[model samples]
Target: MHEVLIVGGGTVGLSAAVFLAHHGVRSLVVEREPGPQVHPRATGVGSRTMEILREMGLADAVNAVAVDMKGISLGKVTVETLAGADFTTMSPSAQVYRDPDFTPARMRGTCPQNRLDGVLLGAARERGATVSYGTELVSFEQDDDGVTAVLAGAGGTRTVRARYLVAADGVRGAVRDALGIGLSGPGVLGPGINNVLFRADLRHVIGETRFAVCSVTTPEAPGTIVTIDGEKEWVFHTNADPAHARDVIRAAVGDPGLEVEIVSVLPWRVRAQIADRFSAGRVFLVGDAAHAVPPLGAFGMNTGVADAHNLAWKLAYVLRGEAGPALLSTYDEERRPVGALAMEQALLRLADPRLHWDNDPAMAAERARAGVVNAPVVQLGYRYGQAVQDLPSAEDVALDLDGSVGSRVPHMWVADGVSSLDLVESRFTVLAGAEDTAWASAGARLIDGWPYGPLLVRPDGFVAWRGTTPDDLPGVLSRLLHTA
Candidate 1:
């Protein structure tokens, strides 16, 4: 029997395998498609996602190929044409990612989903994960002990048993439907949009003004142009027919004479919906399977990656006999709210992009009233209410990781190049303030001026507890893990 059986080979499932393997857990990833798609989708990878990649030692590999958007505004700009003079930045001061001190890891990296999938798949395999393509989960049944899943592939139909099953099978996948999971919030937010992928020499048109997203507002060609390579390859998202792709491309480029070749066109719907339940029995949903957010804030895949990271460590601990089975329940409790919050924020961005950078008191109040937050807050500032429900205040703002329970630990340099985040690994870690006999005897790693005093960090780099007494560590773990 496999330790885990992942139902999809997209970014989320691949990330789950990598994270699980990082903790010495083995998983099998099965995908219906033969391989990764050859197109640009989800070009943004946030700092939090990069931190998880850094923990797996894949930061250099990703940064090596990723396009650095440093100094470039994540806020979208409106232009009459790519070569036109009328260019307006919608959010002038919305640079939440501009601060380098937010994280010691890579701030943000832009890589096409196709390329990112290849990187993750390579790392997952290298770290002892089995990836089988042209195969898919046909059906699954779970009992108290384990899950039995039937898989179909080119070879034939085969049945496999796994201790746990993960469904990363996408929004339209059958796993969630078969499990009878319902979604909440708005289903479809906008009209069907066609992503026209084409090749054109836009170096002269773009010139020195490179942008992540440019809204061409020309009536003749109303669409959004996204830079895939900031060179020849680009994607034009438009409501026009696929037959008019070339015309739209020419109008948006403002260069009728430029040679343009249409590569592929994908039609997708902008949706904002989250599953009512993230897990059922031994099966858990991750990525699009759990929620579908609009592509406004690039939170779809990043949220899924966070879900996989949050679940992987708990599964490892349970399998290692360190934590009880109840620890698995926290996966849905911790990640569901985060996913819902990301979806809400993405919907807000879809309604108004200016909400991303508008952090004034009035705007903050509006956002708070709407039950939404800005990009940085959605990415990193979120607190797990289920983990820290007993605390008076559990929420932490962006870059304010003050060792609160259910919040990510603060990132500070402890060595010449190492960060305080490096102290966390595959197991529960304790970062003690001083070399006290009580702390040392209780297996606390002493560090000077740790700020949190006696801190207990979970396997996934989230704070489990922060208190002055060292003896409370065991009790905290028992309560948090339900391992009495």
Candidate 2:
């Protein structure tokens, strides 16, 4: 029997496998499709996701494959056509330019979904994860001990048993339906969008000036053009039919003579909803299976990656006998709220992409009073467990890290060319001041500050406790891990 079985081999599921492998836990990822999708789905990867990738030792690899669209892809630009005169650009909010000290990780980059998936799949396999494509989960049943699942594929049907099961099969997957889970929140947000992938050379027309997203408002075939490589590879999103794909591309580019080759057209819908629960019995849901949010802020994939990161370590500890089984329940308790919050934020962005960046003092003040925060806060400022109770009534627009419980530890330079974040490993670490000699024997990562107390940092890099005395350290650990 496998220790863990993951359904769906998209970015989120593959990320879960990689994270689990980083913790020395192996998993089997079953994807229905024979291979990764060629067309790009998501183009933006946030800072938090990059940090997690750094922790998994794939940061360099991802950077090599990702395109740096930082300054080039600033905001949305509306143009008459690719080679038109009239242009309207929406200035991005000041919140987009975050403080350099916000994190020790590198800046976020843009990589087509297929490229990112390849990176994750390579890393997961290298780290001892088994990924089987062309496989489908026919049925599954979970009990207290484990889960028994029947999977079908080209080979035939096979029964596999796993200690735990994760559903990453997407928004309309069968596992969630089999579990009888229901969705909550506003359903569909917008009209059906057709992703039209094509090859074209617009370099001569736009030259060095390139916008991240170009909204072509051509009368015949209005659509949005997203740069995949900032060159020939591009994706045009519209509600046009696939039969007239060439016409749509030509009209959007405003160049009837421009040679265009349509590659693929995929239809998708924008949705804002989350599962009523994230888990059932020993089975859990991750990514689109748990929450389906609009892609306005590119929060859907990022949130799913975060869900995998949050649950991977806890599952590792429990499987290793270091934490109690009850600790697993915290996966839902912690991730559900974050999923809901991401859904809410996605909807807000859908309605107004620059809602959090309102310049008016009165509007900003009202938004602040209502606890409206920007992307950084949603990405890095979120907390888990008992730490939620300590959140302020209104969150700041910047990333919040004060060594607080349930929050990620603040990034600080620990040694030459090494960040405090680099010191976090696959075990519970005590971040103590140099003066605190007690934790020295405990193999703590001693750093400045907290001379009056020590911080217990979990394997996932969240602060589990902050206290002055080490006398009750074991008790605190017991409570947090539910090992007692």
TM-score of each: 0.93, 0.93
Please write out the lDDT profile of model 1 over residues 1-484, one tens digit for every residue.
9999999999999999999999899999999988777776678888788888888888888877776666654445678887784444344345433545757777543677777888999999999999999998888899988999999999999999999999999988789999999999889876999998899988777664556777888899999988777788888999999997898889888888888999999889988899999999889999999999898888999999999999998888888888899998988888998898888778877676766655565676666555555565577766687322233322234435677777887776777867778877656888877655478887877776666667788888888888677767778889877789
* Candidate 1, residue 154: how far the Cα is off, in Å: 1.9
lDDT of 2 by residue, 2-25 (tens): 999999999999999999999889
TM-score of 1: 0.93
